[model samples]
Target: MKDNRYSLTGYHKETNEELWLWDDLPELDMEIGYKVGALLHYEQSPFQEISMIETKAFGRMLVLDGTPQVTAKDGFIYNEMITHVAMATHPKPTKVAMIGGGDCGPAREALKYKDVQQIDVVEIDPRVIEVCRTWMTQETDYDRDGRIHTVIKDGYKWIQEQKNQYDVLLVDRSDPYGPAISLYKRPFYQYVYDSLTDDGIAVFQSGSPYYNSDILKKTIGSVKKLFPIVHTYLCSIPSFPGGIWSFTIASKKWDPLKADLNGLQWQEAKYITPEVFRASFILPGYIRSKLEEK
Candidate 1:
Protein backbone atom coordinates (compact mmCIF):
# COMPACT_ATOMS: atom_id res chain seq x y z
CA MET A 1 0.00 0.00 0.00
CA LYS A 2 2.81 2.39 0.93
CA ASP A 3 4.88 1.57 -2.16
CA ASN A 4 1.75 2.25 -4.18
CA ARG A 5 0.55 5.07 -1.96
CA TYR A 6 -2.01 6.60 -4.31
CA SER A 7 -3.92 9.68 -3.34
CA LEU A 8 -7.53 10.08 -4.43
CA THR A 9 -6.73 10.38 -8.14
CA GLY A 10 -10.14 10.82 -9.78
CA TYR A 11 -13.58 9.68 -8.71
CA HIS A 12 -15.76 8.04 -11.37
CA LYS A 13 -19.47 7.30 -11.97
CA GLU A 14 -22.47 8.97 -10.28
CA THR A 15 -23.46 6.13 -8.01
CA ASN A 16 -23.67 6.46 -4.22
CA GLU A 17 -19.99 7.35 -3.98
CA GLU A 18 -17.09 8.75 -6.00
CA LEU A 19 -15.10 5.68 -7.16
CA TRP A 20 -11.38 6.00 -7.54
CA LEU A 21 -8.17 3.93 -7.36
CA TRP A 22 -4.49 4.56 -6.79
CA ASP A 23 -2.53 5.10 -9.97
CA ASP A 24 0.94 4.04 -8.74
CA LEU A 25 -0.60 1.22 -6.70
CA PRO A 26 1.08 -1.85 -5.34
CA GLU A 27 0.29 -5.20 -6.96
CA LEU A 28 -3.37 -5.85 -6.12
CA ASP A 29 -2.29 -9.13 -4.51
CA MET A 30 -5.83 -9.71 -3.31
CA GLU A 31 -8.21 -7.84 -5.60
CA ILE A 32 -9.62 -7.91 -9.10
CA GLY A 33 -10.25 -4.18 -8.68
CA TYR A 34 -11.34 -2.11 -5.69
CA LYS A 35 -14.55 -0.06 -5.83
CA VAL A 36 -13.46 2.89 -3.69
CA GLY A 37 -14.90 6.34 -4.26
CA ALA A 38 -15.78 9.31 -2.09
CA LEU A 39 -16.36 7.62 1.27
CA LEU A 40 -17.70 4.24 0.11
CA HIS A 41 -15.40 1.23 -0.40
CA TYR A 42 -16.88 -2.00 -1.74
CA GLU A 43 -16.13 -4.59 -4.38
CA GLN A 44 -18.21 -7.31 -6.00
CA SER A 45 -18.21 -10.71 -4.16
CA PRO A 46 -15.94 -12.23 -6.78
CA PHE A 47 -14.39 -8.80 -6.44
CA GLN A 48 -15.79 -7.91 -3.01
CA GLU A 49 -14.83 -4.49 -1.71
CA ILE A 50 -13.36 -4.17 1.77
CA SER A 51 -14.99 -4.20 5.16
CA MET A 52 -11.70 -2.82 6.50
CA ILE A 53 -8.65 -0.69 5.88
CA GLU A 54 -5.64 -0.89 8.29
CA THR A 55 -3.43 2.16 8.41
CA LYS A 56 -0.77 3.45 10.82
CA ALA A 57 -2.36 6.91 10.83
CA PHE A 58 -5.91 5.87 11.67
CA GLY A 59 -4.74 2.68 13.43
CA ARG A 60 -7.09 -0.17 12.43
CA MET A 61 -9.06 1.89 9.92
CA LEU A 62 -12.22 0.47 8.29
CA VAL A 63 -14.53 1.81 5.59
CA LEU A 64 -17.58 -0.30 4.80
CA ASP A 65 -20.28 0.41 2.22
CA GLY A 66 -20.44 4.21 2.08
CA THR A 67 -19.48 5.23 5.62
CA PRO A 68 -16.21 5.72 7.44
CA GLN A 69 -15.64 3.28 10.29
CA VAL A 70 -13.25 3.09 13.23
CA THR A 71 -9.64 4.17 13.10
CA ALA A 72 -6.81 2.58 15.10
CA LYS A 73 -4.67 5.64 15.87
CA ASP A 74 -7.09 6.95 18.48
CA GLY A 75 -8.13 3.40 19.34
CA PHE A 76 -4.50 2.58 20.13
CA ILE A 77 -4.45 5.01 23.05
CA TYR A 78 -7.10 3.16 25.01
CA ASN A 79 -5.58 -0.14 23.87
CA GLU A 80 -2.10 0.75 25.05
CA MET A 81 -3.38 2.11 28.33
CA ILE A 82 -5.55 -0.95 28.92
CA THR A 83 -2.79 -3.40 27.93
CA HIS A 84 0.37 -1.84 29.31
CA VAL A 85 -1.21 -0.73 32.55
CA ALA A 86 -2.26 -4.30 33.29
CA MET A 87 1.09 -5.75 32.21
CA ALA A 88 3.14 -3.17 34.05
CA THR A 89 1.24 -3.84 37.27
CA HIS A 90 1.93 -7.54 37.01
CA PRO A 91 4.92 -8.84 38.96
CA LYS A 92 6.17 -9.90 35.54
CA PRO A 93 4.55 -10.26 32.10
CA THR A 94 6.59 -12.82 30.15
CA LYS A 95 3.87 -13.98 27.78
CA VAL A 96 1.00 -12.23 26.04
CA ALA A 97 -1.52 -12.98 23.27
CA MET A 98 -3.16 -10.38 21.04
CA ILE A 99 -6.12 -11.71 19.06
CA GLY A 100 -7.26 -10.19 15.75
CA GLY A 101 -4.66 -7.45 15.42
CA GLY A 102 -3.87 -8.18 11.77
CA ASP A 103 -2.46 -4.69 11.50
CA CYS A 104 0.11 -5.72 14.17
CA GLY A 105 -0.08 -2.30 15.90
CA PRO A 106 -0.70 -3.57 19.41
CA ALA A 107 2.02 -6.20 19.12
CA ARG A 108 4.38 -3.46 18.05
CA GLU A 109 3.25 -1.25 20.96
CA ALA A 110 3.46 -4.07 23.54
CA LEU A 111 7.10 -4.80 22.75
CA LYS A 112 7.96 -1.51 24.49
CA TYR A 113 7.88 -3.32 27.82
CA LYS A 114 11.25 -4.89 28.52
CA ASP A 115 9.72 -7.67 30.64
CA VAL A 116 7.59 -8.97 27.74
CA GLN A 117 9.52 -11.92 26.32
CA GLN A 118 6.96 -13.63 24.08
CA ILE A 119 4.08 -12.02 22.23
CA ASP A 120 1.77 -14.10 20.05
CA VAL A 121 -0.13 -12.15 17.36
CA VAL A 122 -3.11 -14.07 15.95
CA GLU A 123 -4.76 -12.47 12.96
CA ILE A 124 -7.50 -14.12 10.87
CA ASP A 125 -6.27 -12.78 7.55
CA PRO A 126 -2.84 -13.55 6.14
CA ARG A 127 -3.60 -11.14 3.31
CA VAL A 128 -3.91 -8.43 5.94
CA ILE A 129 -0.48 -9.41 7.22
CA GLU A 130 0.92 -8.97 3.72
CA VAL A 131 -0.78 -5.62 3.08
CA CYS A 132 0.20 -4.17 6.46
CA ARG A 133 3.90 -4.77 5.88
CA THR A 134 3.63 -2.51 2.83
CA TRP A 135 1.19 -0.10 4.52
CA MET A 136 2.41 0.11 8.15
CA THR A 137 6.06 0.83 7.48
CA GLN A 138 9.43 -0.81 8.13
CA GLU A 139 10.82 2.28 9.86
CA THR A 140 8.57 2.33 12.92
CA ASP A 141 9.86 0.58 16.05
CA TYR A 142 6.34 -0.72 16.78
CA ASP A 143 6.53 -3.13 13.83
CA ARG A 144 10.19 -4.05 14.34
CA ASP A 145 10.15 -5.66 17.78
CA GLY A 146 11.75 -9.07 18.25
CA ARG A 147 9.24 -10.44 20.76
CA ILE A 148 6.40 -10.74 18.22
CA HIS A 149 5.70 -14.11 16.57
CA THR A 150 2.90 -13.71 14.03
CA VAL A 151 0.34 -16.52 13.64
CA ILE A 152 -1.88 -16.39 10.57
CA LYS A 153 -5.00 -18.13 11.90
CA ASP A 154 -8.33 -17.52 13.51
CA GLY A 155 -7.75 -15.95 16.92
CA TYR A 156 -10.44 -18.09 18.49
CA LYS A 157 -8.89 -21.27 17.12
CA TRP A 158 -5.43 -20.22 18.23
CA ILE A 159 -6.67 -19.26 21.69
CA GLN A 160 -8.49 -22.58 22.00
CA GLU A 161 -5.47 -24.63 20.90
CA GLN A 162 -3.08 -23.14 23.44
CA LYS A 163 -2.67 -24.94 26.76
CA ASN A 164 -0.06 -22.55 28.05
CA GLN A 165 -1.74 -19.47 29.54
CA TYR A 166 -0.81 -15.85 29.03
CA ASP A 167 -0.15 -12.96 31.45
CA VAL A 168 -2.37 -10.68 29.38
CA LEU A 169 -4.94 -11.11 26.59
CA LEU A 170 -5.46 -8.12 24.32
CA VAL A 171 -8.43 -8.46 21.94
CA ASP A 172 -7.29 -5.97 19.32
CA ARG A 173 -10.12 -6.60 16.93
CA SER A 174 -12.11 -4.60 14.41
CA ASP A 175 -15.66 -3.64 15.34
CA PRO A 176 -17.76 -6.77 15.96
CA TYR A 177 -18.49 -7.65 12.33
CA GLY A 178 -17.24 -9.81 9.47
CA PRO A 179 -14.55 -12.23 10.73
CA ALA A 180 -14.73 -10.32 14.03
CA ILE A 181 -18.38 -11.32 14.55
CA SER A 182 -17.26 -14.36 16.51
CA LEU A 183 -15.05 -12.29 18.76
CA TYR A 184 -17.93 -10.56 20.55
CA LYS A 185 -19.71 -13.78 21.50
CA ARG A 186 -19.95 -14.71 25.19
CA PRO A 187 -18.47 -18.14 24.52
CA PHE A 188 -15.40 -16.36 23.20
CA TYR A 189 -15.18 -14.35 26.44
CA GLN A 190 -15.31 -17.57 28.46
CA TYR A 191 -12.59 -19.03 26.26
CA VAL A 192 -10.57 -15.90 26.96
CA TYR A 193 -11.23 -16.40 30.66
CA ASP A 194 -9.94 -19.96 30.44
CA SER A 195 -6.90 -18.98 28.37
CA LEU A 196 -5.52 -16.50 30.89
CA THR A 197 -3.23 -17.07 33.82
CA ASP A 198 -4.81 -16.50 37.26
CA ASP A 199 -3.57 -12.89 37.12
CA GLY A 200 -4.66 -12.36 33.54
CA ILE A 201 -6.51 -9.33 32.18
CA ALA A 202 -8.54 -9.19 28.97
CA VAL A 203 -9.02 -5.89 27.21
CA PHE A 204 -10.95 -5.22 24.00
CA GLN A 205 -11.77 -2.30 21.73
CA SER A 206 -15.37 -1.38 22.39
CA GLY A 207 -16.94 1.06 19.92
CA SER A 208 -17.49 4.81 20.17
CA PRO A 209 -19.09 6.53 23.13
CA TYR A 210 -20.85 9.01 20.89
CA TYR A 211 -21.98 6.41 18.35
CA ASN A 212 -23.15 2.78 18.72
CA SER A 213 -23.80 3.21 22.43
CA ASP A 214 -25.99 0.11 22.51
CA ILE A 215 -23.33 -2.06 20.93
CA LEU A 216 -20.74 -0.84 23.40
CA LYS A 217 -23.04 -1.42 26.35
CA LYS A 218 -24.07 -4.88 25.22
CA THR A 219 -20.47 -5.91 24.67
CA ILE A 220 -19.45 -4.52 28.07
CA GLY A 221 -22.32 -6.37 29.72
CA SER A 222 -21.20 -9.59 28.06
CA VAL A 223 -17.65 -9.19 29.31
CA LYS A 224 -18.98 -8.32 32.77
CA LYS A 225 -20.90 -11.59 32.76
CA LEU A 226 -17.61 -13.37 31.95
CA PHE A 227 -15.29 -11.53 34.36
CA PRO A 228 -15.51 -10.09 37.86
CA ILE A 229 -14.34 -6.63 36.82
CA VAL A 230 -15.30 -4.68 33.72
CA HIS A 231 -14.82 -1.02 32.99
CA THR A 232 -15.04 1.23 29.91
CA TYR A 233 -12.73 4.05 28.94
CA LEU A 234 -12.54 6.66 26.14
CA CYS A 235 -10.18 8.54 23.81
CA SER A 236 -10.40 11.02 20.91
CA ILE A 237 -9.07 9.93 17.51
CA PRO A 238 -10.15 12.21 14.68
CA SER A 239 -9.99 9.82 11.72
CA PHE A 240 -12.62 7.41 13.06
CA PRO A 241 -16.30 7.76 12.16
CA GLY A 242 -16.98 9.07 15.63
CA GLY A 243 -14.54 11.59 17.03
CA ILE A 244 -14.01 9.81 20.37
CA TRP A 245 -13.92 6.02 20.90
CA SER A 246 -14.20 3.59 23.82
CA PHE A 247 -12.65 0.38 25.16
CA THR A 248 -13.57 -2.18 27.78
CA ILE A 249 -11.11 -3.71 30.21
CA ALA A 250 -12.04 -6.95 31.98
CA SER A 251 -9.95 -8.65 34.58
CA LYS A 252 -9.87 -11.52 37.05
CA LYS A 253 -7.11 -10.12 39.29
CA TRP A 254 -5.77 -6.71 38.19
CA ASP A 255 -7.44 -3.33 37.70
CA PRO A 256 -5.85 -0.95 35.19
CA LEU A 257 -6.16 2.41 37.01
CA LYS A 258 -4.50 0.90 40.04
CA ALA A 259 -1.73 -0.83 38.05
CA ASP A 260 1.86 0.30 38.52
CA LEU A 261 3.90 0.82 35.35
CA ASN A 262 6.86 -1.07 36.93
CA GLY A 263 9.20 1.81 36.01
CA LEU A 264 8.82 0.85 32.36
CA GLN A 265 8.88 4.45 31.21
CA TRP A 266 7.91 5.38 27.66
CA GLN A 267 8.50 8.55 25.74
CA GLU A 268 5.70 10.98 24.90
CA ALA A 269 3.08 9.96 22.34
CA LYS A 270 0.66 12.29 20.55
CA TYR A 271 -2.44 10.73 22.09
CA ILE A 272 -1.68 9.00 25.40
CA THR A 273 -0.18 11.22 28.06
CA PRO A 274 -0.10 10.89 31.85
CA GLU A 275 -2.84 13.50 32.12
CA VAL A 276 -4.84 12.11 29.19
CA PHE A 277 -4.35 8.59 30.56
CA ARG A 278 -5.85 9.57 33.88
CA ALA A 279 -8.54 11.67 32.22
CA SER A 280 -9.55 8.90 29.82
CA PHE A 281 -10.72 6.79 32.73
CA ILE A 282 -13.09 9.52 33.86
CA LEU A 283 -16.15 8.92 31.71
CA PRO A 284 -18.46 11.81 30.92
CA GLY A 285 -21.99 12.14 32.39
CA TYR A 286 -23.66 11.02 29.16
CA ILE A 287 -21.48 7.94 28.72
CA ARG A 288 -21.84 6.96 32.36
CA SER A 289 -25.61 7.03 32.05
CA LYS A 290 -25.33 4.97 28.89
CA LEU A 291 -23.62 2.26 30.94
CA GLU A 292 -26.17 2.76 33.76
CA GLU A 293 -23.15 3.20 36.03
CA LYS A 294 -22.95 5.90 38.66
Candidate 2:
Protein backbone atom coordinates (compact mmCIF):
# COMPACT_ATOMS: atom_id res chain seq x y z
CA MET A 1 0.00 0.00 0.00
CA LYS A 2 2.84 2.36 -0.86
CA ASP A 3 0.49 4.65 -2.81
CA ASN A 4 -2.98 3.83 -1.46
CA ARG A 5 -4.10 0.79 -3.51
CA TYR A 6 -5.20 -2.42 -1.84
CA SER A 7 -7.36 -5.49 -2.51
CA LEU A 8 -9.27 -7.68 -0.07
CA THR A 9 -7.77 -11.07 -0.78
CA GLY A 10 -9.26 -12.64 2.32
CA TYR A 11 -9.80 -12.30 6.08
CA HIS A 12 -7.32 -13.47 8.70
CA LYS A 13 -7.60 -17.20 9.45
CA GLU A 14 -8.45 -16.88 13.17
CA THR A 15 -8.88 -13.11 13.65
CA ASN A 16 -11.46 -12.77 10.85
CA GLU A 17 -9.96 -9.36 10.28
CA GLU A 18 -9.92 -8.06 6.75
CA LEU A 19 -6.65 -8.88 4.95
CA TRP A 20 -5.86 -6.75 1.94
CA LEU A 21 -3.24 -7.07 -0.81
CA TRP A 22 -1.58 -3.67 -0.50
CA ASP A 23 0.33 -2.42 -3.52
CA ASP A 24 1.30 0.95 -4.92
CA LEU A 25 -1.46 1.62 -7.44
CA PRO A 26 -1.81 5.40 -7.27
CA GLU A 27 -2.91 5.76 -10.89
CA LEU A 28 -4.48 2.75 -12.60
CA ASP A 29 -7.76 1.46 -11.15
CA MET A 30 -7.02 3.52 -7.99
CA GLU A 31 -7.93 0.50 -5.86
CA ILE A 32 -8.16 2.42 -2.57
CA GLY A 33 -9.69 5.67 -1.29
CA TYR A 34 -8.65 7.87 1.62
CA LYS A 35 -10.30 11.03 2.95
CA VAL A 36 -7.20 12.94 4.10
CA GLY A 37 -4.91 9.90 3.81
CA ALA A 38 -7.15 8.05 6.24
CA LEU A 39 -8.49 4.96 4.49
CA LEU A 40 -12.30 5.13 4.24
CA HIS A 41 -13.01 2.02 2.25
CA TYR A 42 -11.70 -0.17 -0.54
CA GLU A 43 -14.02 -0.99 -3.46
CA GLN A 44 -16.60 1.37 -2.05
CA SER A 45 -18.60 2.01 -5.24
CA PRO A 46 -20.07 5.36 -4.13
CA PHE A 47 -16.54 6.84 -4.03
CA GLN A 48 -13.37 6.14 -6.01
CA GLU A 49 -9.98 7.85 -6.01
CA ILE A 50 -8.97 8.99 -9.48
CA SER A 51 -5.39 10.08 -9.81
CA MET A 52 -4.44 13.08 -12.03
CA ILE A 53 -8.06 14.25 -12.28
CA GLU A 54 -7.86 16.73 -9.40
CA THR A 55 -10.56 19.40 -9.22
CA LYS A 56 -9.63 23.00 -9.85
CA ALA A 57 -13.32 23.76 -9.24
CA PHE A 58 -13.12 24.54 -5.50
CA GLY A 59 -9.50 25.31 -4.74
CA ARG A 60 -7.66 22.04 -5.28
CA MET A 61 -10.24 19.51 -4.15
CA LEU A 62 -9.51 15.87 -4.75
CA VAL A 63 -12.41 14.55 -6.79
CA LEU A 64 -12.36 10.84 -6.31
CA ASP A 65 -13.74 9.40 -9.52
CA GLY A 66 -15.84 12.56 -10.14
CA THR A 67 -17.29 12.75 -6.63
CA PRO A 68 -16.56 15.32 -3.91
CA GLN A 69 -15.17 13.10 -1.17
CA VAL A 70 -13.33 15.27 1.39
CA THR A 71 -12.23 18.89 1.92
CA ALA A 72 -13.74 20.87 -0.94
CA LYS A 73 -11.30 23.15 -2.68
CA ASP A 74 -13.55 26.20 -2.58
CA GLY A 75 -14.81 25.74 1.00
CA PHE A 76 -15.73 23.59 3.92
CA ILE A 77 -19.43 23.22 3.21
CA TYR A 78 -20.23 20.30 5.53
CA ASN A 79 -18.07 21.63 8.34
CA GLU A 80 -19.60 25.10 8.17
CA MET A 81 -23.09 23.68 8.06
CA ILE A 82 -22.52 21.47 11.09
CA THR A 83 -20.79 24.07 13.30
CA HIS A 84 -22.69 27.21 12.28
CA VAL A 85 -26.07 25.56 12.81
CA ALA A 86 -25.40 25.02 16.50
CA MET A 87 -23.58 28.33 17.01
CA ALA A 88 -26.43 30.31 15.44
CA THR A 89 -29.04 28.62 17.59
CA HIS A 90 -27.49 28.87 21.01
CA PRO A 91 -27.78 32.41 22.34
CA LYS A 92 -24.06 32.70 23.14
CA PRO A 93 -22.03 29.55 23.03
CA THR A 94 -18.91 30.96 24.66
CA LYS A 95 -17.14 27.74 25.55
CA VAL A 96 -17.43 24.77 23.20
CA ALA A 97 -16.13 21.23 22.92
CA MET A 98 -15.59 19.26 19.72
CA ILE A 99 -14.89 15.54 19.70
CA GLY A 100 -12.93 13.93 16.86
CA GLY A 101 -12.68 16.85 14.43
CA GLY A 102 -9.09 16.22 13.35
CA ASP A 103 -9.51 17.97 9.99
CA CYS A 104 -9.68 21.33 11.85
CA GLY A 105 -12.45 22.42 9.48
CA PRO A 106 -15.10 22.44 12.22
CA ALA A 107 -12.81 24.48 14.46
CA ARG A 108 -12.28 26.96 11.63
CA GLU A 109 -16.02 27.25 11.13
CA ALA A 110 -16.74 27.55 14.85
CA LEU A 111 -14.15 30.27 15.41
CA LYS A 112 -15.97 32.53 12.94
CA TYR A 113 -18.79 32.88 15.42
CA LYS A 114 -17.14 35.53 17.57
CA ASP A 115 -19.15 34.56 20.60
CA VAL A 116 -17.32 31.24 20.83
CA GLN A 117 -14.28 32.39 22.79
CA GLN A 118 -12.73 28.98 23.54
CA ILE A 119 -12.98 25.60 21.82
CA ASP A 120 -11.53 22.31 22.98
CA VAL A 121 -11.07 19.63 20.34
CA VAL A 122 -10.66 16.13 21.80
CA GLU A 123 -9.31 13.72 19.21
CA ILE A 124 -8.16 10.12 19.67
CA ASP A 125 -5.87 9.53 16.73
CA PRO A 126 -2.72 11.64 16.59
CA ARG A 127 -2.03 10.14 13.18
CA VAL A 128 -5.26 11.58 11.70
CA ILE A 129 -4.35 15.03 13.00
CA GLU A 130 -0.80 14.73 11.70
CA VAL A 131 -1.98 13.59 8.27
CA CYS A 132 -4.54 16.39 7.89
CA ARG A 133 -2.01 19.05 8.89
CA THR A 134 0.65 17.60 6.62
CA TRP A 135 -1.68 17.02 3.65
CA MET A 136 -4.60 19.51 3.61
CA THR A 137 -2.93 22.23 5.68
CA GLN A 138 -6.20 24.07 6.36
CA GLU A 139 -5.75 27.73 7.31
CA THR A 140 -6.84 27.25 10.91
CA ASP A 141 -3.41 26.29 12.18
CA TYR A 142 -3.99 24.13 15.26
CA ASP A 143 -0.66 25.38 16.61
CA ARG A 144 -1.45 29.12 16.84
CA ASP A 145 -5.01 29.71 18.07
CA GLY A 146 -5.39 30.83 21.67
CA ARG A 147 -9.14 30.22 21.67
CA ILE A 148 -8.66 26.72 20.31
CA HIS A 149 -7.05 24.00 22.48
CA THR A 150 -6.34 20.34 21.99
CA VAL A 151 -6.63 17.46 24.46
CA ILE A 152 -5.40 14.36 22.67
CA LYS A 153 -7.37 11.47 24.22
CA ASP A 154 -10.50 9.33 24.10
CA GLY A 155 -13.42 11.77 23.74
CA TYR A 156 -15.99 9.64 25.52
CA LYS A 157 -13.73 9.03 28.47
CA TRP A 158 -12.78 12.68 28.59
CA ILE A 159 -16.43 13.77 28.52
CA GLN A 160 -17.17 11.59 31.52
CA GLU A 161 -14.57 13.57 33.49
CA GLN A 162 -16.07 16.98 32.77
CA LYS A 163 -18.41 19.21 34.74
CA ASN A 164 -21.57 21.09 33.75
CA GLN A 165 -20.02 23.93 31.72
CA TYR A 166 -19.93 23.82 27.94
CA ASP A 167 -22.43 25.93 26.01
CA VAL A 168 -22.30 23.73 22.92
CA LEU A 169 -20.65 20.41 22.11
CA LEU A 170 -20.11 19.12 18.59
CA VAL A 171 -19.38 15.47 17.90
CA ASP A 172 -17.65 15.67 14.54
CA ARG A 173 -16.87 11.99 14.63
CA SER A 174 -16.87 9.29 11.98
CA ASP A 175 -19.83 6.93 11.66
CA PRO A 176 -21.29 5.31 14.81
CA TYR A 177 -19.79 1.90 14.03
CA GLY A 178 -16.39 0.20 14.08
CA PRO A 179 -13.71 2.23 15.90
CA ALA A 180 -16.35 4.81 16.89
CA ILE A 181 -18.55 2.33 18.74
CA SER A 182 -18.21 4.04 22.13
CA LEU A 183 -19.60 7.24 20.64
CA TYR A 184 -23.05 5.63 20.27
CA LYS A 185 -23.26 4.16 23.76
CA ARG A 186 -26.18 5.30 25.94
CA PRO A 187 -23.82 6.11 28.83
CA PHE A 188 -21.79 8.38 26.60
CA TYR A 189 -24.91 10.29 25.58
CA GLN A 190 -25.79 10.66 29.24
CA TYR A 191 -22.37 12.13 29.94
CA VAL A 192 -22.87 14.58 27.10
CA TYR A 193 -26.14 15.61 28.73
CA ASP A 194 -24.41 16.07 32.07
CA SER A 195 -21.48 18.04 30.64
CA LEU A 196 -23.66 20.75 29.15
CA THR A 197 -24.99 23.93 30.73
CA ASP A 198 -28.74 24.15 31.35
CA ASP A 199 -29.29 25.64 27.89
CA GLY A 200 -26.45 23.88 26.08
CA ILE A 201 -26.92 21.98 22.82
CA ALA A 202 -25.09 19.11 21.15
CA VAL A 203 -24.92 18.35 17.43
CA PHE A 204 -23.61 15.10 15.97
CA GLN A 205 -23.13 13.40 12.61
CA SER A 206 -25.47 10.40 12.79
CA GLY A 207 -24.99 8.54 9.52
CA SER A 208 -26.56 7.93 6.11
CA PRO A 209 -30.32 7.75 6.72
CA TYR A 210 -30.93 5.23 3.96
CA TYR A 211 -28.41 2.61 5.04
CA ASN A 212 -28.50 3.05 8.82
CA SER A 213 -32.09 3.99 9.58
CA ASP A 214 -32.27 1.75 12.61
CA ILE A 215 -29.07 3.10 14.13
CA LEU A 216 -30.06 6.69 13.35
CA LYS A 217 -33.53 6.25 14.85
CA LYS A 218 -32.20 4.52 17.92
CA THR A 219 -29.63 7.28 18.51
CA ILE A 220 -32.33 9.93 18.31
CA GLY A 221 -34.56 7.97 20.66
CA SER A 222 -31.72 7.58 23.11
CA VAL A 223 -30.81 11.26 22.93
CA LYS A 224 -34.45 12.26 23.32
CA LYS A 225 -34.51 10.28 26.51
CA LEU A 226 -31.54 12.36 27.72
CA PHE A 227 -32.18 15.85 26.33
CA PRO A 228 -35.70 17.29 26.37
CA ILE A 229 -35.50 18.44 22.76
CA VAL A 230 -33.95 16.54 19.84
CA HIS A 231 -34.10 17.23 16.12
CA THR A 232 -32.46 15.71 13.04
CA TYR A 233 -31.28 17.43 9.87
CA LEU A 234 -30.17 16.15 6.46
CA CYS A 235 -27.22 17.13 4.30
CA SER A 236 -26.14 15.88 0.92
CA ILE A 237 -22.67 14.36 0.40
CA PRO A 238 -21.78 12.58 -2.81
CA SER A 239 -19.51 10.09 -1.09
CA PHE A 240 -22.19 8.98 1.36
CA PRO A 241 -25.05 6.76 0.27
CA GLY A 242 -28.62 8.05 -0.40
CA GLY A 243 -27.14 11.47 -1.30
CA ILE A 244 -28.53 12.70 2.04
CA TRP A 245 -26.90 12.25 5.47
CA SER A 246 -28.41 12.44 8.95
CA PHE A 247 -27.44 14.78 11.81
CA THR A 248 -29.06 14.97 15.24
CA ILE A 249 -29.33 17.95 17.59
CA ALA A 250 -29.84 17.50 21.32
CA SER A 251 -30.36 20.26 23.83
CA LYS A 252 -31.48 20.70 27.37
CA LYS A 253 -33.19 23.89 26.20
CA TRP A 254 -33.12 25.18 22.60
CA ASP A 255 -34.62 24.60 19.14
CA PRO A 256 -32.02 24.32 16.41
CA LEU A 257 -34.31 25.56 13.63
CA LYS A 258 -35.64 28.53 15.58
CA ALA A 259 -32.05 29.78 15.95
CA ASP A 260 -31.35 33.41 15.12
CA LEU A 261 -28.80 33.48 12.33
CA ASN A 262 -28.21 37.23 12.56
CA GLY A 263 -26.81 36.81 16.05
CA LEU A 264 -23.95 34.63 14.83
CA GLN A 265 -20.85 35.60 12.83
CA TRP A 266 -19.39 33.89 9.75
CA GLN A 267 -16.46 35.02 7.65
CA GLU A 268 -17.77 33.58 4.36
CA ALA A 269 -19.03 30.27 3.05
CA LYS A 270 -19.73 28.56 -0.27
CA TYR A 271 -22.87 26.83 1.04
CA ILE A 272 -25.17 27.15 4.13
CA THR A 273 -27.07 30.31 3.37
CA PRO A 274 -30.22 31.44 5.21
CA GLU A 275 -32.31 29.86 2.45
CA VAL A 276 -30.30 26.65 2.78
CA PHE A 277 -31.06 26.69 6.51
CA ARG A 278 -34.82 26.80 5.93
CA ALA A 279 -34.74 24.10 3.28
CA SER A 280 -32.62 21.78 5.41
CA PHE A 281 -35.34 21.66 8.08
CA ILE A 282 -38.10 20.54 5.75
CA LEU A 283 -37.54 16.81 6.01
CA PRO A 284 -39.65 14.13 4.33
CA GLY A 285 -42.97 13.22 5.95
CA TYR A 286 -41.70 9.89 7.14
CA ILE A 287 -38.68 11.44 8.84
CA ARG A 288 -40.76 14.15 10.53
CA SER A 289 -43.23 11.64 11.97
CA LYS A 290 -40.40 9.41 13.06
CA LEU A 291 -39.10 12.28 15.23
CA GLU A 292 -42.65 12.67 16.71
CA GLU A 293 -42.82 16.40 15.90
CA LYS A 294 -43.25 18.66 12.92
| Candidate 1 whole-model C-alpha lDDT, 0 to 1 | 0.64
* Candidate 2: residue 275 lDDT (0-100): 70
> Clashing residue pairs in candidate 2, if any?
58-73, 58-74, 59-73
Off by over 4 Å in 2: 1-69, 73-75, 140-142, 289-294
How many clashing pairs per prediction, in order? 10, 3
Residue 116's lDDT within candidate 1 is 86
- On lDDT, the leading prediction is 2
Local error of candidate 1 at residue 91 (angstroms) = 4.0
Segments of candidate 1 deviating more than 4 angstroms: 1-82, 139-144, 262-264
Error of 2 at 164 (Å): 0.7
lDDT by residue (1-294, candidate 1, tens digit) is 323333333223324443433222122242223344234232322211334443444444444332333354564554455465555556677798998766566676677677889999887666555545554424366455677888877887777776539888888766665667888887888888888888788788788787678778887888888788777878776655546888787888777677554443346444565555567789989888878952
| Model 1 collision count | 10
